[model samples]
Target chain A: MKWQIISSDQALYFHSWDNECVVYNSLSGDTHLLNLTASQILLKLQQSPTEAITLAKLVPPTDQSESHAEHELQIEHLLAELNALNLIEKCQSTINYNPPSCR
Target chain B: MNISTLTLSELGHRLKKAGMFLQTGTFITHLKTSIPSVAEGIRLLYADYPLVEHLDFADFHVSLTYPRNLRRWLKPQIQFLFDGKPPFKPLPADQAFPMLEWGLNWCVSSHANHYLIIHAAVIEKGGYAAVLPAPPGSGKSTLCAALVNRGWRLLSDELALIHIGDGRIVPLPRPISLKNQSIDIIQSYEPDAVISRKISDTMKGTVAHMKPPANSIIRANETAHAGWVIFPKYQSSVPAQLKKLSRSRAFIRIADNAFNYSLLGIKGFETLTGLVDASQCYDFTYSSLENAIETFSALEPPASSK
Candidate 1:
């Protein structure tokens, strides 16, 4: 599935400092404090709707434990979290399947 | 003219009769009261504030009086009247003066939407203001008093009125309210500081007010640009440390602290973003005023911002 920012690109304002980002949603009049990973995902989604595997590429490795499989899983969880907050929404339906690493 | 120009008897007489239009910072208050403690509180603290002999309008027309009910004499409670209407329940007669101060603060915070008001203590030096946003018992007031007594100018002890258009801080220097042990600490910290009489057994136990510096009141027209936003927390036995905080975190904290952030909607968000752009954010912790002062004095903004 592909996820996209719920609001227009202009409605989501970004002010980033180092690794943290603060997004002010003009549509709902809410401000959110997000970590670098969440910020990058939102930024990517704002530009264009993208798949979980594509969003996973934005995350750089933090430690030896972070493999490609873990990065994809983390991105999927973040996308769901953002969708839950009404910050983003699912644009397209994909198969109800998981990667072989998780299965 | 100033309230000091009037004798104590004259001040009380004016308050009993037609209210005097007293100017503190940018707002004029038409204050009238039959309660002597409120009169004395104004006389003691607002001596240097400007007064208008005749005025057409006032931002707040407030008065304090004992209710006609049995509570007036049974327990002797005083009610704060905003335009002859009570906004809050009556307090003990002894707490009349504090009620007036609090009511005046409420007047500004509730109605004044021209600026994005934040619940913070503001101080200025070298053409820049440091905004200290903290919750109660965080020692922001104590730190603010110590800073002003040392050298910095007190912009305000409570509300920080950041103009929506220019993002400059409009000075609203009012008396600093000290609670619990802070009252005694300030007295010991500054020997010359004049504080009001302590009133006990109110909502905030054992409260006293330190008179704002006359110079701050006199220079109320001067405004300062945003420079730094520091969130200070008092920790016992902790070394004074100034840690760099992310601008995003500070942005959320300040918006949460703002009085009209939600009311102003999109404008508040834009104004806050501009503020965070210009200020460096920090989290400060200290137990000693002297050490805190040293740490603050050493703070430097970029040359470009100046």
Candidate 2:
């Protein structure tokens, strides 16, 4: 999975691990972990206005046959939790949801 | 006597309407603002608070103007315009533009009577406050922003006001300001955080304000006894570490960060010395908020026998 560098300078790189649905910042010599689900939803949202499958595509399947429905439901629950945390912002327009400004 | 006495709802309406209100124990200010957007912004920021009239310390009233000229020359006018009895120093004639309003509030109203203010971040749990005093570019704001987003109650993100007399911390609980990368770091960490519009092209790069946590606002007037004074420096890759600092060394370090230490003369020294006697001092170097938070959470009061 590729990690996107959202913010970085000479000493620190804040990146999102799309595969793990986590955000981490590497600085000086330490790596800090951010909320997992929030990181995932944000990356998914960044890709496009993803529905359930779009998120599941980023993660591995628990079971071949049930992966589709299970992942969809999980994404729904994840989105709710993220919303409560103010991580995945809501948008009025159907087209896109621009993330809030950095810091 | 303090404006904080007002309920959040009252403060919201008065600031939006550009009305006059009381503050602190003295001084009166009348605000006059025409910008509807700025009006709404102020309203939302003071949401649920009573009008500024509730402040007890000052009797001053201010009227703010919208699209308001945020010029540097207005500092002195603002200082004089919000004057009180028995005479106060006139506002300095020269200053910088789009100057931070709440930052000034922390300097003037903090409970500390002796020490000058240090631009820094503070978070307290169990009465101990970690004071992150860093010059700009030290990643202090970024680390402070992340910690407060998690669970720490923000004492402040820009000003650490230490009381000189008893060494207690005066709670100013103002909004947190983030610039450039920090803004993004916070959004990634906690999406729901309420942030203000970005004001661009400033000397410190782009800037925006984070609404202080709701609970902090309610307790803004509450003061905390200084427990541990931890000066944090955030370097990206280092493991979290805390080192004890001698009281004499702490005094020197704190004085370097102070805003008006020289102005207060002996009172400032006495106030700082008293604070040192009451608190434990340390230097916290870290790249991990988790370790930092855990270390802070596990701190035993200096009085605890171990």
Model 2 chain A worst lDDT window (10 residues): A21-30
Q: Least accurate stretch of 10 residues (summed lDDT) in model 1 chain B?
A: B297-306
TM-score winner = 1
Estimate, for each residue in B65-161, the C-alpha lDDT of model 1 and write its tens digit.
8899987657899999998999999998999999988999999999999899999999998889999999888999999998999889999988999
How do the residues A30-54 of candidate 2 rate in per-residue lDDT, one tens digit apiece?
Answer: 2233445445556556554555566
Write down the RMSD of all candidates, one decimal each.
4.1, 22.4
* Cand. 2 Cα-lDDT: 0.56
- The top-ranked prediction according to lDDT is 1
- lDDT per residue for candidate 2 within B242-291, as digits (tens), equals 89876656666776777766566555555655666667888888876677
- Cα distance off (Å), candidate 2, residue B77: 16
Each model's lDDT:
0.88, 0.56
Candidate 2, what DockQ? Answer: 0.01
Q: Which residue segments of model 1 deviate by more than 4 Å?
A: A7-9, A58-65, A92-103
